[model samples]
Target: MDGQDEVSAREQHFHSQVRETTICFLLFAVLYVASYFIITRYKRKSDEHEDEDAVVNRISLFLSTFTLAVSAGAVLLLPLSIVSNEVLLSFPQSYYIQWLNGSLIHGLWNLASLFSNLCLFVLMPFAFFFLESEGFAGLKKILEDLDEQMYMITLEEEALQRRLNGLSPSVECDLLDLEQELQNVKTLKAKLERRRKASAWERNLVYPAVMVLLLFETAMSVLLVACNVLCLLVDETAMPQGSRGPGIGHASLSAFGFVGAALEIILIFYLMVSSVVGFYSLRFFGDFIPKKDDTTMTKIIGNCVSILVLSSALPVMSRTLGITRFDLLGDFGRFNWLGNFYIVLSYNLLFAIVTTLCLVRKFTSAVREELLKALGLRKLRLSSAPREPDSAKPSANGHQKAL
Candidate 1:
């Protein structure tokens, strides 16, 4: 009787997972397609000028597609694997068949996981490159050069002043040339000041975007873990009775869940700190009202916070609903909807973060060039007239006084 009940439960559990997976995949596919279309259209519009950043954007799109393809493949294969076990019992014996039947599903899952992990690694360095390439680093270099130029000019002025000491008043041309150079230096100094201000503005936007992307990646990691946990739980319940140790099954699931929860806690802290820092830094350095399309950083941070809140709420719901309990002999089931909820929330956060960083970095680079021009540092030239020889000979008394 118990065995019969267990079989019935397992069948039901399998069907439920199939349904949930189907729904989730459909939703993921829709979003993925929509995002692709939007990005493609944007690229087409921007491609006329052949902007240098176009290549970076394309790279991001490629990575996004790779991530989606691998993830979708894994999701699709999971249900097929389950169905195959029930439906295909007597295939011809072959090594390939055994490998496909036994190991392919696991391989697909690992492949999907690898793609998702690669997204993070790819995005971080990409963001850094975008920030640097957008002229943020160049601006800093220019400022340093300006400061050094100003110092050199000041040293020249001091030397010129000393040279003028005890000289007759006849060297008017030399004095005039020195004065002109001083005026030119002053003009250049003003220009450098303007460039510095512009650079600060650009940094304000790009830095926040980068920080938001990092938070988004962290949230995605949390979501991937949650999804894996859900899949694992379903697999466990669908397994035939006596196939695995009861204690080991429970211990493993619980450990995975605990680790995920711990990660959630750490991510929440990260989101909070990053958001606060980014928000204030932007306000301090840039315009408070970000341009419509340039508001990606704010949006990404907002998504991260929302996910953090949702993930934190799940443990409470799990404890309250008593959904954590599962019979080892019975089919897999999720009375705990918390895991699925967290997964969706985490994915959204990740998407928002990556998109925002990419956009902001590009926009800030454009703004930096404008600022440099406004500061008059764009191709400034300095020249001084030839110095005239001193006409008056120094008297013996004047020479003694100089000594």
Candidate 2:
């Protein structure tokens, strides 16, 4: 009887644990959804039509301040989280110190989780603005210069044709000028090609960075929701023997939650592939847009497409991810170094690398050339001057050949 009672008690305890986990997970899922609506609906409103110097609206100001505070708090908590870990915060043998160490770990873990969750609200929106604003001005200047060169090439071609058609003495006198015009055209074309390449390179870097962060956030949101739903269903089955089985409605909830999670995961993967395709398409076909009349429309369309791709994923993302928590030292019985690594990599390292690479490719010609070469791409090289007559070549019978 005691053995049976112990088994029953164990089952009851298991169900209780499942219930608590499910509750926490559900709360996280709800927060994730709420964050999506709050950010997408309200945060974007903050960016619309406000002057640089204008007094900030209350909603905008509150969100901005909140975002800044969360980000700052996350940064500040990192050191404390590290030092407070059981392995690092070790003290000489004392009951009080041991208790303090455990308390610190518990406190830091929760604090880090809170900050991490709050940080998500800022990351996605911040990335959109960061990438767009950073690249737009420089990219616009490059495009303008490219358009100017195309105009000059047209004029220079006409002048060359007129010079060629003129009477012998008149044309002959201006032959050198015609050659100079041709050279100018060649130079301008080269510059335009270089600029186009730079633009393409920047586009490659910026697109990936933005997409990765957005996807990561979305995946986390959906996963959390799925896990929550799963736990709740498990909790029902884990009930004590005398308890009633889960109702049909509970089963349906499990099914829908699971289906929703799977669909979201699939969608995020599709978005990633689409982002790559879109970036390449823009880079290659962008020049096909008429430089004179429709450039602005092309830019607007491009931005819309990007926004659409990102926004489409927001629903699933909000359902899944929220705050990230990592226990680096196995204090929580698992070494979550990978999770911590991902947080650092996704949020900090990757952004810096992508931004820096794009800026470098845009500004430095030599570096651009090297990058293209390394990637095995061929750049347009200027044609070399014709070689002198083969008389300069070794004579067929060199010994006695006359000049």
lDDT (Cα atoms) of all candidates against the true structure: 0.45, 0.43
Report how far off residue 384 is in candidate 1 (Å).
99
lDDT of 2 by residue, 346-399 (tens): 433343355345444544776555545544453555548776665567666775
Best by lDDT: 1
> What TM-score would every model get versus the actual structure?
0.27, 0.22
Q: Which window of 10 residues has the lowest lDDT sum in candidate 1?
A: 323-332
What is candidate 2's local distance difference test score? 0.43
User: On a 0 to 100 scale, what is the lDDT of residue 99 in model 1?
Assistant: 31
Question: How well is each residue in 273-325 modelled by candidate 1, as lDDT tens digits?
Answer: 54445554665534442233343322222332332333233323222222222
Worst 10 residues of 2 by lDDT: 239-248
